[model samples]
Target: MLKLIRLEWRKHRFAGNFLGAGIAMIGILLFLIMIGFLDQGTEDFAFLDYQGSFILIDTFARAVFIIFAGVLISKLIISEYRDKTMNVMFTYPIKRHKIIAAKLILVFIFTFAMIMVTDIIMGALLLAVNQYYGFITEPLESKVLWQMVVKYTISSISAAAMSLIPLFFGMRKHSVTATMVASVLLVSIVCSGFSGSNGPTMSINSIIIIPLTLGAVGLWIAALSMVRLETKDLN
Candidate 1:
């Protein structure tokens, strides 16, 4: 499994998708900071509240990651079919499902790690800005900081898992655009549904379970597709 993952990384090392994601993260963070400054005069703006800021930042990060995961799925999986390289991939001694699993695992890990890092960085930046400008209603407390970390950790994992939905789209039609478009639409729905709500008010378990289950189902679909790949004509 490790060998297959390593091979996959080697194939995509220069693809520039990771670089693009990093740039997008930075851009989003800067935009959030700018919005905070702009909202300083509006007492009712959600960004004025520390807790609200955390939720808002997390929402934006998750939205970005959904799109990021879609692009990676397109590059890593859909591109193989479009480029007629699946036949080459099939020549390897490894089982077809294992190869697909490695790719999916890589996507999940990358998405999760990047989201966490970006979220933490954004939180720190926001804290610093608030401290200097006194925009936030309440001062940053250790308890609040800890809560932000915990909430973001769970949210990042969920976002990573949810991002896999695009894999199903990509595998079905082998169209990169369709995969990415589907991701954008899904993120739009999710963000709209939770726009004003706090992070998973129902329960922590609900927060973790829903996205995890969705991710698992998407992976199951992808794996079944791999089984078909074993005999399907590449032509």
Candidate 2:
């Protein structure tokens, strides 16, 4: 399994994806830092508070990385099928199911890791900026930071799994458009936790429910697809 995963990693270095993610992360960071300065205490900026800021940042991270996963599904999986490279892959010694599973594993790990790391970096910047500007004015404590980390970690896991849901759509004819669109819609649904309001829908208890549920569904679909790939002709 490790060898297969390493082979998939070698096949797609994801350099473009990493560059794109870095650019988006920088944009999110700039927005987060500037958000404090733009604060006017209006309802428009209500989600600019500590927790709300975290939610907003997490939302951006989730949405970005999920789409990143979608692009990866297209690049690593669907596009290969469309271009008939999958035929070449099947001719190799590797089992069909193993090949797809390896690709899925890479996607999951990459999405989860990127989301967690990005949130941590952005959350730290939020803390540092708050310490300097006193914009949020909420007393920072070790517990609060720990809580943020816990929440971000959970959300990252959920998002990474949920991201694979698009595979079900993409595999129906290997339509890249369906895969990408499904990802966008999935984000719209799961990320509806906050808007410009003071009452953020993203609470600790509510955080894990939707994403985890859909993530399970995605995993089931992926497993089923792998089973089908064992017999389905790639020719």
Candidate 3:
């Protein structure tokens, strides 16, 4: 599986994709850093503390990576069929399902890794900048920091699975555009209310069940997508 994943990375534009992801993360971090200055007059707002800022970043990062996963799928799987490039791969001694599974697994791992990495990097940067700027409204507690780690780990896992949901859509007609659209729509629906409302204000990471459920569905679809792979015609 690792060998297959490595080959996929080599075969695709993963280097450029990683570069794009890094640029996206930097943009997200900068925009978040500006929020403190932009909301100076408001009595209360988001990104004012470790907890709020962490949730906000997780939402943004997950949404971004889901799209990344979609693009990876297009390049790794959808484009293979659209361009008839996978026929070459189908000639290999390996089982067809293994090839497909490797691609999906790669997408899953990439999404999870991106979400966790972005949160940790952005969180640390915020904490460091807050030390000098004092823009974050509250002090971060050791307990709260640990909580963020646990939550992020679980969320990343769920999001990684959820990232595969677009495979079903893209495979329907081998449409890369549909895959892209599905990913953005998935993010909009899943992350739109990430920090749910409680009374008049918001609560951080309040709803995890939605992603968990959707992620399970994604896994199911991913498995189902391979059911016919064994006898699929490359001709």
Candidate 1's error at 116, in angstroms?
Answer: 0.5
Return whichever of 1 and 2 wins on TM-score: 2
Model 3 residue pairs with clashes: none
State model 2's lDDT: 0.81
Best by lDDT: 2
* Order of models, best lDDT first: 2, 3, 1
What tens-digit string does per-residue lDDT give for candidate 3 at 24-128?
Answer: 898888887687677665655565556667777788888889888998999899999999888788899998889999889888887898889999998888788
Expressed as tens digits, the lDDT of each residue in 1-235 for candidate 1 is: 9988988888889346678878988889778867766765664465756776776777778888878888888988889988888768878887878888888888888889888888888878877877777766566779878977887787787778778887777766689988998899878755543333522223222355666676677667666767777565354
lDDT of 2 by residue, 151-170 (tens): 77887888899899999899
Worst 10 residues of 1 by lDDT: 197-206
TM-score of 1: 0.86
**How many clashes in each structure?**
0, 0, 0
What lDDT does the true structure give each of the candidates?
0.75, 0.81, 0.81
Once fitted onto the true fold, the runs of candidate 2 whose alpha carbons sit more than 4 angstroms away are 33-39, 44-48, 194-207, 232-235
Q: Model 3 — TM-score against the truth?
A: 0.90
